[model samples]
Target: MTPTNILSVEAYFDLICPWCLIGKRHLETALGLLARERPDVTVHVEWRSYPLIPATPPDGIPYRDFYVARLGSPQAVAVRQAQVCHAAREAGLTLALDRIETFPNTLLAHRLVRFVRRQSGAEATAALIDNLFTRYFIRAQNIGDGQVLSDALAECGVDMPGASGTPVRHDLDWLPPLNGPDDLPPRTGLGVPHFVFNGTHSVSGSRPPAALLEAMQRALARAKQIATRTAA
Candidate 1:
């Protein structure tokens, strides 16, 4: 496709994060809107793994207890859950937080994504990511389990590597430093559901579809402007 004909979106997310799941839904909605309104633009999305809790044991920790400790109190956790649930409902997703039992370390989960992307392609990798988020958040399955990850790969029409028993180590040192709008200084902390549009503009958090759509448009326009200047 020509430069103007394509739009690139890079999404940084983690499977165990409820907000990332909600953000995925919102991003999908925004893509659909782009498809309907801007048929001439072919969007390519690249999913980058960002493990929220990389230190948790592979076997996992009790979900409720982990959150309770993280939030400092049951009441605080409840309030946070309510807020997440409301946002999830708005995005047409159901947060089954109660169904979750274990809070798994997502190192393996992210490795699985990279494996799928290398083997099949970005499309299959995206499918695997969606499946994983559903399994973790909605189905409340232990995503860190080797068998579970193997099964998830199979569901996405990917082959289970023979080395599945061995944990795959990933190097995330290549991730670009996050820089926000011009007026705002670069953020030192990383956040889930972060989006980079055409590698030129970025939006953070689980923003609404409208906001994401605007980011995409702005990125596309900026790209075209640069391309035009270059062609001149």
Candidate 2:
């Protein structure tokens, strides 16, 4: 596995997952560090869709109530929110959890991501993903809504389909199915924000930028070693 100048990062995530957003920010920071420290390496990130709450209605359910039920009590939900807020702040993000009113089914959102990725590229798709996160978590907008998704696409400079005027399509043959926790090697528990580096190394959860940077370095080194061995 001779290391090439290009390094690929595959991130499996769900749109509504709070920790995924934080992990994305940390990964961006790590990439910035890599740019400064390893100028020779070009990093590419591919976002994989994983719907965390596939059963939620497209219209969504009361956000607060959903959390209260999931966490077993209102107080528990509040405690979890506080913990998430603190973690988000460390990642330089402000999660407006109170503003959110709905917990939406993310199937449409994931399909929209695949549509954007096909129409444009990874950079544009990433921009749309970021916007989706902001809309859902920060702006409290329902991303599962067709109109909301159309507006988001426009914001990302992507044109909506003429007849439908919405990006939501039932056909997701192009986008690969979400990987089960067992699919990836070296498991670290089932969770979003799973970052697979160079197809050989992986880091789970919202790791700090420093830790992510170290993982990237290790992946790069391993790739180089493999390439060297192959060449010989």
Candidate 3:
């Protein structure tokens, strides 16, 4: 197939969401599995932004309390978190929920990611995303602080303010509504870590890579059928 015939998928995610991280890993695993079977098909990805808890305060708040109030009772929250932790471990990922004191506004982090995207391609962007997750989930670092972000960016060879010149802060207003055409409404106006495949099919929440791969294959197949019909 021609390069134009290749498939492209856009993913919307937030760094703070544990399920998003698991979903990402599962997608990667699915891609690797697909590669072994079909090497000819090219799958391209674009990352978008979706803040799960946009109101997350700076300096961080107690994540446990936040979940309890937002989700249910403290005991219920703990149980839910345990389930997530198990899922993460099953996915070969370590989730340090204790370290996440509060969910900071991820607008700045998303901007930094966009900046990294500009400096490096998708692979680099993916690496940076993974690194950010590791820093929070594994190291339990405070990612809400500018200094912490600058340090992380610097480690990735990404230039940030304070390190070189002025520090760059993200504009939250401009951060959202970054997905598609200027007029298209956002999918899952509330849910985060949304994945839109071929700009047609959208999967809300973090899904397994097998699900994503299947979505891509379906999109590709439909496109091919349309092309064949038009030609015939």
Q: Report the C-alpha lDDT of model 3 over 1-232, residue by residue, as the tens digit.
A: 6633576777777888888888888778877876776688788877766766656775677666778888879788888889999999989987888767766666567767776776687887887888788887778876776667766776777654444666465322233333445212364564656676666666766677778778767777777777778889
Candidate 2 per-residue lDDT over residues 1-232, each given as its tens digit: 2256679998988889999999999999999999999899988888887777788876899999999889999899989999999999998889999899888988877877877777798999999999999999889898888678878887998765553565444333344543544223344345888899999888889999999899999998888888788889
Ten contiguous residues with the weakest lDDT in model 1: 175-184
Q: Stretches of candidate 1 above 4 Å error?
A: 162-188
Greater TM-score among 2 and 3 belongs to 2
CA shift at 75, candidate 2, in angstroms? 0.7
Compared with the true structure, the alpha-carbon lDDT of candidate 2 equals 0.83
Q: Write the per-residue lDDT of candidate 1 for residues 99-128, one digit (tens) a residue.
A: 899999888778778767767888999999
User: In model 1, what are the clashing residue pairs, if there are any?
Assistant: none
Alpha-carbon deviation at 157 in model 2, angstroms = 0.2
Task: State which candidate has the highest lDDT.
Answer: 2
Candidate no. 3 TM-score: 0.84
Off by over 4 Å in 2: 163-189
